[model samples]
Target chain A: MACETDKALLQENIEEYIKDDNKVVTCKWLSLMHSIDINVAKRALHIFVHHQRNKGGNDDINVTFFVAGLGKSKDGDLMHKCAVVPETELEVVKRSLATVTSCHIFSVQKAKLKDYTPLYMTDYEVIKDNIDKCNRFSSIKCPWVSLKSGLSASKSAQQDVVKVVLSENKGHAFSNKTETGNDSPGSKTRALAKKVEPKGSITSMFASASKKDGGGNESSKPVQKTDAASKIKATKKKGGVTAFFEKKGDSPLKQKDVLLGKDSKKMDASSERFESNVTNEKKQDPKRKKKQAADADEEAPDKKRRRRIKTDLFDSSDDEDVEAGEPEEPEEEIEEMEQFEVLDKGIEEEHKMTEEEQKEEVDDSSLTKSAVVGKKRKRTKKVVSKHYEDEEGFMVTKKETVWESETDEEDEASVNKQEKKSHQSNTSEDMGKLATKNTKAKADPKGKAAAKKNSSPQKSKQTSLMSFFKKK
Target chain B: MFEARLVQGSLWKKLLDSIKDLLNEAIFDCSSTGITLQAMDSSHVSLVSISMNSDGFDTYRCDRNLSMGIHLPSLSKIMKCAGNDDIITMKATDDADTVSLVFESPNNEKVSDYEMKLIDLDTEHLGIPETEYSCVVKMPSAEFQRICRDLSQLGDSVVIACTKEGVKFSASGELGTGNIKLCQSASTDKEEESVVVDMNEAVCLTFALRYLNFFAKATPLSTQVQLSMSKDVPLVVEYKISELGFLRFYLAPKIEDNDGDN
Candidate 1:
């Protein structure tokens, strides 16, 4: 092969060429260009031309490949040339470069080019994709220059300084173009739109890319698209390529929706419903505040919205934030119940005297109240709360006749719920009260004393249970 | 009658300091070899066994093999009364219910004696069989203590994996996964300072960090700590007290439920 002849000729002047003069090509420099065995530098020189393939251009331009040497300035163009034998393949060049760089070929990667991203050039795929760039030198500009056993290495070192300044200038200009491109309104709008759209568009883009890369294999297409889309999304969001493979599937929309559905089926249904109840408990006033009555009506619909949020495919981050915010809900209900208990105790003491005198004085003044106990836990709470809203209306009218001057700071909302609860307990307590009242009526004619003992403690248990659920 | 005197009372004080956080009481079995204490914590998740040889003590005397059940907190309270260099003498009758601790200060400057009542505790003595551990890693006690302390803040449990390369302590939780790897250090001037791993085969086990933190109390007693582990068996963390015997801690592994997938 032609490469073999070129490799042998380069090996002859390996030591002289490696001298620190402008021609000294170290393995460190060559490893950046291509993956090569660093050990090869110990044996021979590796010289090859890099054919620059300008995107949208057919002509392949010759670019001097400087492994670790100074470039000679000629006509304002910085070009590095070295004397070497001919017919070397890119592989031989990479092996020779690896020897100088002292880096394994598998670890090398091409620097980020204008068109393509910085890719792992260690594999055959990267080499095959950029085959045009791996061409052998067509002609040596400085053919007469020869590096013998003894030569001054200082000549090459001086030339490298000029090449370094030129490269820095080029890098600055290239970065400026990219900054302007990103700043354009058109580009900004497109990026923003991509964020707004669900993952459906990204999935299609991934499908197309996979189809082009992997050919007609449809079975593995979904998996590959998921990997690619997730990789892109993770990198975009995290601003680092390292986050690409951090998760199994991190596509923002489809995967999250799927996750939400599964989470909803598992725990979302109860947790979401729990959130609404908490929100109601927090906002609801124990006093008969008009706003509290309005909030109760709105709470019925909020529960449906919570259930809807669970069934509908949606993002969970927002849902999680709401859940964390309402942890104080349970504490509020306990506070409201305490205030209502104080009012109920005062009412019991006032009614205690009248009940003792008229043993059958079942005060029918509270009969018009909605104390209808419905079947099941849910309906019972709904019927009781609804009755409280109605009782508040009657409580306003009957306040003067019954417990006068007790209006301010009294939580009628809680009082209404407690009143319904106490009423329910009274009916149960009524059964016990009747039996006891009959014994007291026969034994000592003090039926009111026995009735008070049975009703008071049972009413407290009922109030505690009411606060425990706080069912809106 | 049973009496054992420790020349360095500070060491025994640290031994009690390490366990008082987890266990309230323990039985001290006085045997001819020395004094051995083996007991489990309240949850029965961890077992701590301490044995001191008769040769290790300055003066040791036991007429008969006796077991004295004592509350650890009360004993630790008495231990705190003794100065670092004080001579601690533990005396209890074979059939008596209370134990007296005599603390003789350095140069006999001041001496204080405390008699703490002992309870009759009916605790089953578990005979731990000899386990052929797959991996044994010897490392600096301070390093082990620091790793356990730091990683406990990250998770409730830690996974200890031992291989030919090194021993790794890994914890994964809401924050993320953290791993501390200690490779066998190259032989230096002090061999004890270097981490050494001896493996018959690789073994990986998960244990609760809560117990590990409790066991790390023995860090002050020994310079080096050894971790012996086998698959599905409790991991043993042993700290060998020079001239004395060793303090060994055994903790049950948290088994992964395959069917329940917990």
Candidate 2:
């Protein structure tokens, strides 16, 4: 059985392969068996489609199982039966799952993810009328059939119209208006940064700090640092959202439906923090800083953004805040969660932040209450970066200032992993449903859907295309 | 996309000859560029540097700037399968850490992705001397292999003395003295070649023939055999492999230390 997490990755990869007219895509199906490069598969598919269009007459030739396994035929090509002595159980399972998932994405079925099955071809027009408008046949072959179905037959171009929209918006970072240069899709960055813990040197420093005192230590530092951090964020998050909402209208959020939470308890929580978290992104790290006026401009934005996020925590503090007087203790928990979420997202976005933004996390940690007021320090000043070492004892130094030039597609695996995690969270009904469809293709081979019939000779091309690899 | 399921029962094999010189005992210290790998018969030598494109399985989808730090576990897998004729596909998803390989064995029985690891191959020893040779020669690996095989029968110690023209390999026994001569000529007339001597300097150093035989077993074929020595200085024999570079060994001649034959 494939694990839930891996299944999710398999599903996404499969879906992305078949989602569009992916008739021309290249996908690498990774299972326990040997890897099949899809680019080669596509060329094979092109040849198969070419073969189907070439032989206009349908004689029901029995060929290999691709779409053929489940007693169905694909975009009409030659057919082959399953190999008599099948591959190992694991290979059989993976191949079977791939076929089923591929069929579900290509053929028409119910709009809902659960109702999808590989049984029916989506377009009845092609099936009932026996006419594929988009496909073109240059010739026909079959001894029993009429020789009259000649050269240059064509079919209509029906672009795949059913789009696969993720059920949940898969939340993007909010109030992250600094455009911190620290940018990558949330899902991928999380997997990698999560895997690469900030433990190398800084962790040892933490251990040494605990040990250096001969066992009786200054355990009070982390708590104080946390408190100070919370205080600073409380003061900054306010204007951040106001700026984004007051102007941009966040039209992108509409399509994502991040507001999809069903419960009033959750909605109220989302809405309040949502207002601050969502709307206040407008007040950023001085989007339009004065050219050279150092002290004043530097102080304004940091204080404002932190103040906004911090205030959003207190003002909303979960549904309990609705009572006007929530207990102070529980209130603090909600505040920390919101702050952590906000900060985590900030770190996520700050992926591209110049050396300047990196210094903020480092410097802010070192600040005493009086420092922010007394110094008109330029944010870019190296002195601020130095301050962070004094405070965090150098955890921030271990992290890259920002990833500069990498593209976005590289994170697909990590994003797929994140999708699985969200499914694990079972965040919502729709999100779960959407996630389930993707996960099914990758998870266990046992519950695999039966393969449909389509003579996808694309596989032979895959083997052939892969031939050049050893030499290359 | 098309997919195939392969069962396990596949075989992959490859036979690569060292067209260049190689001293197998020196496989560890060969420089990346100095025939660290060469054809088994002194045909070609290659300087190789294997580097990871990214930290894990990541590779540039196209030619672009990518910086990835590979781990060790993955590299060993690649090295293990270098001789396999299986299909190997290393595809990098967007994540730098994500890399996958599909290894399809020649028998088509199974294909699996073995992970790749990044390692730093540093074999340059700072203080080692780039030894200057006083005497050198070119001989097949088999000839030396055979000579070592035959010389061990006489006694353990085989003395190698060289002049400008050729080398004289002699081993002494209580019953008699055995001497083999290799001259510079192709030996058109003589059934056995003689050791041509001009005597710019005549130096003899004795070494255990058993050690020489063991060294040959460890090496691939050799088209050239080079021996560099000074009276009692260590002798250096190196074999250059085509693409793999050279393998070398340095052995100090045996001396009759204080407790002779005790």
Candidate 3:
């Protein structure tokens, strides 16, 4: 009756059921009774008939076979026919057909069958009773059918209950049936449903089932209820497209914060974390780290010192905040904050580097004004050098040249110097005035001084743009 | 030594274009008979098999069997440089580290040669056994491509159902479900355009549309595409490459979650 067929039990059941002289045993009847394959039942019937004939006393057993074949009709079209014939007439029936596709024992009896009406009626009754279990012993199994025990009776009862409870809700019954079928596999189909059934229906079913039991851990009931509630919430969240858009919309705001330099404290924390992560990565490849360290020492010691000081300040502040908040807050919140801080600092540093490069270009143009002078016209070449760390942590130096012209060289030189002086004065004043208001403003002067020191050696060589174009 | 030449150089270009998107690198096995390539996509969900007979080439010669592992995108880039009417001749010596390709104009006025380094690739050759499919459908390659393209807009996976009556392609997603059914065409006058379904039993399987779209790139190589399918087996999509041989793609079906249940 289960998935596997018991051959010994099947043979015994066939022998016992055919002991009655008036009772006839059909292959379909035996298959439905023992839940064995139809072909296996037919083979068992043949063996039983053969064994009785071999007894050598009174051979009264009669066997009939089911024959199906493709035969031509009068119109020349292929006509498929299936008929039940006695064992003696099987060969004659086979000779009359074009091709015998299948020939299996149809039934076993004591007397030869005059009419097949009783056999059909009895087999129909058996099939009608076991219609739901007809596919139980089939080779191809349906997952929804096999998942439940006492499938036929219980499923009908549950369907009746669903109908009474949710008479107006069509999807409720369908979804409930799928839910009770298989949990995970059916969930995919449920997720694909266009109109999701209300959560109340699912929970109500659970509530009703629990009430029917009437006795369990009362304390555990509310916990299970809350679990179901949260699961409902999760499914609701997963079903919406707005949640995805909301997440995408939040990233640009964070980028804007980094660009505006509004959260320096957060930026410092993040940069510290970024440095730690970089050091961790460098530890994996020490040779690259050593080379980068050597390059850093040769290129910008002052910037390194500034970075160290800022990191130390950030570490001390972070320690104080952790000591203050450790007792009340969880560690996960702190970790999330650290991650956000690191991301903010990386973006902020990139933006700041671009701004510094632009300011350096402006400084180069200003310095070139003091070098070039001519009687009629003057042309000045400005070299712009950019320094950045590559992914391998090596310093990459890129240089570009810009040519400028002025009719009155001396006048332009004086004006450029004054403009540079005013810019420097304004920055220095802003640094001192807004020292407490903005930490970023305080770092500007140091960056400008470093840029000037790096660019001082290139001032002597300046060329006019007109020199290249002159047709001399 | 091994050498082969093709009068229509554009065939190689189209072949490379068809496979370059699916494979990053492939190994070409060349023998006295022909050249064949078998490779799986990066995801390993789909496999591509190509064969060309030596008789199809204008001239062919081989002293020994050779396996050349070449980067496909790079080869495609080089193939793009050849003119449509240029005669392409590929030559390589025994135990050679590089292969040379010469492109000669029809009038013998201009000639260009390019050499590419071969890589030593460790490859495991999979032995594919021939199988009898329950259902085999032959339809216009363009129509198949159109169906795959249109269904991809509705879902990520397409369910192909082949019955005695006809074959149906359907896909369901957040937007809606779309079904396209093709009945056996009654008229066989234009054999290339007729839709034929030869089936012993009905089989329905689901496949990823993204890979089907990739396989459909061979539409220009042949007018007809053959789709062979069976239950619990990979589907084969084949396109005959004119007088050359065929390009076949085998895609594993998307196993439903319930299929794993005992």
Best of the candidates, TM-score: 1
Per-candidate RMSD vs. true structure?
A: 30.5, 31.1, 32.5
Q: TM-score of every model?
A: 0.40, 0.24, 0.39
Give the runs in model 1 whose Cα sits over 4 Å from its true position.
A1-335, A341-472, B259-262
DockQ, per model, reads 0.01, 0.01, 0.01
Cα deviation at A168, candidate 1, in Å, is: 99
Rank by lDDT, highest first: 3, 1, 2
Name the regions of candidate 3 deviating beyond 4 angstroms.
A1-472, B259-262
In Å, residue A298's CA in model 1 sits off its true spot by 20
- The superposed Cα distance between candidate 1 and the true structure at residue B202, in angstroms, equals 0.7
- Minimal lDDT window, size 10, model 3 chain A: A415-424
Model 3 CAPRI quality: incorrect
Candidate 2 CAPRI-style tier: incorrect
lDDT of 1 by residue, A156-226 (tens): 22233344345445545554554454444543443333342342332333334433333212212223234
What is candidate 1's lDDT per residue for B177-221, written digit by digit as tens?
Answer: 789998889475686788998899998778778789989988998
